[model samples]
Target: MIQPLDSVIVHTLTRVITPVIQLFALYVLIHGHDSPGGGFQAGTLFAASVILPIIAFGIQGSLSVLERRAIILGGIGILLFAGIGLLPLILGGEFLNYGKLPIPGMEASARRHWGILGIEIGVTITVAATAVSIYYSLRERGEGEEK
Candidate 1:
């Protein structure tokens, strides 16, 4: 059995810091287009936020938060990315040609902006799910061997 920490300071600090980490991850995700960060970086940070509970509480606790939905999340991401690409084709343009998107109120550049944002959201989901899946797989393997 995995032993949790007994220190009050450790528990308290973890509780306080985890939300801040998650909020910062959101900030990174939102501001990525205008700044140095992007989907990959934000996803990693988001995964790190998920990981903090694992470190503090254990895999079972973290699994409650993550569930078994990692693969589903990845699939959704793939669909989002591919669907956006295919949309342009269906609208009589080349793949991922954001200019061909038919939003009535938006110019071509605005359409492109929304398209990029959609792509980034897809990438973020894929990366975060992949990272969490890997972490859970490794932890499960390690636990299995200890028995």
Candidate 2:
């Protein structure tokens, strides 16, 4: 629920820019470990990704597009990270120790790198989506909440 004042500036820009931002965030998330970016950076990018649409289309519409499944996304992310960590424990190694991932024919170093990457990806998605939701909620002033 955008106030008339918010409609003038934020809404217009977000209406056109959110999709592009989301795409960029995915690119960053996928390329994170190899490039200069990682989970934290990519997460912020994703947060910004949703902001435009939220500002433009209003909170409800934005939720229809992305926000509605925020908790589900976060759950999956947690599972991914936890699964990776559990693999090590099952293999008799320390937590987050990917030497236990059981990837056949992969070198130890390579396995470790891959594990870190998977964990980072999960972190990025959960954190970014959460941030976006919070930002939208805070921004949606004058929407007239019910008692």
Candidate 3:
């Protein structure tokens, strides 16, 4: 159990800055396919946003907000990535050949763009959830316990 800090400055700053960080993370995730930032960077930003509160308010409190949701998100991410990858194979194309994705009215190039975006989204969610899960596991260990 993380002991909640009593400092007003820390709590106030965390509350104020967390949302901004999350918004920036979303921006990074969205523009990643075209720009420099991508799933891994955005996911790290998002994980850090969640962790800011955990650090200021304590793990037990943050757990209620993120624990189950994180697990579910991780599962969703994996399923999405696998489903997208397999869709191409099922359609008689190689795995991850997004040109064969069944998006009605989309040109092959467009479908490829959308498919890459989907993959990036899946990666972002998986990375963020994994980071949060790792943080929780590490923080929840018993005092004096070694792993």
Candidate 4:
């Protein structure tokens, strides 16, 4: 069992800062196409956002929100990436050849742009879920050893 903190200041600060962290993470993910921030950076930020509650409220509290979804999230992310790549192949183009994508209103450049965005979204999901899974697994192992 985890003990609740007695510090009001810490709790309040954590609550306030966590949302800001998440917002910044989203900004990084969205603006990555035009800037330095991208899937890896944004994903790390997202994982940090999830982890902040663990620092404040312990693993139990964090797990209550993250649950057992980390692996599922990671798998879904990989599938999305692979599926997008394979879509071009299924459309009679080389794998990941976004130029041949069948969007009706988009030029080849726009198709490639959308394809890159899809890949970035996949990478973001995979990285964040993998980071959270590692954290949760390590914490669980540490708790077992402590007992």
Query: Which ranges of candidate 3 are over 4 A from the true structure?
Result: 142-147
lDDT per residue, candidate 2, 1-147, as tens digits? 453334557666665677777787777877876778788788888887766565555655566545645757777878888988998998899999997788899998999888988899889977887886677556654465531
The lDDT of model 4 is 0.84
What's the CA error at residue 144 for candidate 1, in Å?
2.0
Q: Per-residue lDDT for 1-147 in model 1, tens only?
A: 556667788778889998998888888888987988878888888788887777777775576546456867988988998998889999999999988877789899999998888888888888888888788777767767878
What C-alpha RMSD separates each model from the true structure?
Answer: 1.7, 3.1, 2.7, 2.0
Q: Poorest 10 consecutive residues of model 3 by lDDT?
A: 138-147
* Model 4 Cα shift for residue 52 (angstroms): 0.8
Q: Over the full model, what C-alpha lDDT does candidate 2 score relative to the true structure?
A: 0.75
Tell me each candidate's TM-score.
Answer: 0.91, 0.77, 0.88, 0.90
Q: Candidate 4: which stretches are off by over 4 Å?
A: 1-5, 65-67
| Candidate 2 residue pairs in backbone clash | 14-52
lDDT of each: 0.81, 0.75, 0.85, 0.84
* Residue lDDT tens for model 4, 29-126: 88988988988998889989887777677776676446457978988889988888999999999998988877889899999988888888888999
Mind giving the per-residue lDDT tens digits that candidate 3 earns over 1-147? 346798999999999999999999999988987788988898889999988888888765486557546878988888999999999999999999999999999999999989988998898899999899888767767322644
Candidate with maximal TM-score: 1
Name every residue pair that clashes in candidate 3.
none
Residue-pair clashes per prediction, in order, are: 0, 1, 0, 0
Candidate ordering by TM-score (highest first): 1, 4, 3, 2
In candidate 1, which residue ranges exceed 4 Å CA deviation? 64-67
Candidate 1 has a TM-score of: 0.91
lDDT winner: 3
